[model samples]
Structure formats: structure tokens, C-alpha cells
Target: MFKKISWKWYVGAIIFTVSLALIFPLVGLKSYVNEVAIISESLMIVFSYKLMIKRLSGPVTFFLGLLVGLFWGVALFSLVGVIYNIN
Candidate 1:
């Protein structure tokens, strides 16, 4: 299963992970961090849709990615809020 998946999908995920790691030090605001996390999650969702499932139309993939990204963003934002509150 998944033998034909493109290498680009894995490459994109690697890039996102690297960027997410590097971005932590530059983030001074929680809002910016949340934005970055959501964007990364959206990209990953796109990669997932392309890799693990049959191709979907652009709008379908976009909406699915946005939905998943927003869910992840809310969780991330809540964690961030907790950390800020603790400090």
C-alpha cells in the first residue's frame, strides 16, 4: 500500500517540521505562533491528502485542510494560553 506516493510529500513534511522547530525562537507573540502552527498543519493535511488518499479537487482538499488545520490550531492555541498563564 502507498507504494506510488511521491517523494515530494515526505519532503514537504520534513520542511514543515524543520521550519516549525526553527520558528520557536523567533516567535514573540502567541498570535503569530498560532498562525504558524495552523499554516503548518494545513500544509501537512494537504500532504496527507495527496499521499494517503486518492486525489481530490482543489477546493475539496483546501476545505479539508482548513478544517483540520483550524482544529489543530485551537488545540495549539489552548496550550499556548496555558503556558502564558503559568508564567
Candidate 2:
């Protein structure tokens, strides 16, 4: 499923995750959380596009990974906002 995603997507994900876990704590939103979420969703699209390119050997797995990643991004932003009240 998601295996089609380029390593770049994971790189983006990791960067975003780390930013949320580390930088978001100190800087808070300042409107940055939305940017982070957008980037995360973009990464999901990248994953999906890669899957499409592969003709989707395993559509479910690929879609599920994209979905999970998208949701994870949303959830991450929500969590950061909760602790830091960036929302």
C-alpha cells in the first residue's frame, strides 16, 4: 500500500513530527500548526501519487497508510494545540 511512497514523504513526516514534538512546544502555533498539517496532508498525497504510479499492487495497504498518515498529522496538530493552546 504505502510502500509506494517515496522516502521523501517519510522524511517530511519525520520532520513534521519532530517539529511538533519539539519546536511546537516552544514556539506554539502562531499559525504554523496549520502549515504543518497542510504539509502532512501533502505528504499523504505524495504517498498516494506514488501508489498510483505503481498501479497500486496493494491499494488497501497503500490507501490505509496514506489515511493513517493524514490522520496522524491532524491528530498531531490537535495535540500540540491542546498542550500549548495554539488553537
TM agreement with the true structure for every prediction: 0.46, 0.52
lDDT of 2 by residue, 32-52 (tens): 656666666666656555546
Give candidate 1's total backbone clashes. Answer: 0
For residue 35, model 1's alpha carbon misses the true position, in angstroms, by 5.1
Error at 21, model 1, angstroms: 7.7
lDDT of each: 0.58, 0.64
lDDT of 1 at 44: 63
Question: Model 1, stretches more than 4 Å misplaced?
Answer: 1-32, 52-58
Candidate 1 colliding pairs: none
lDDT of 1: 0.58
* Shift in Å, residue 70, candidate 1: 1.3
Clashes within 3 Å, all models in order: 0, 3
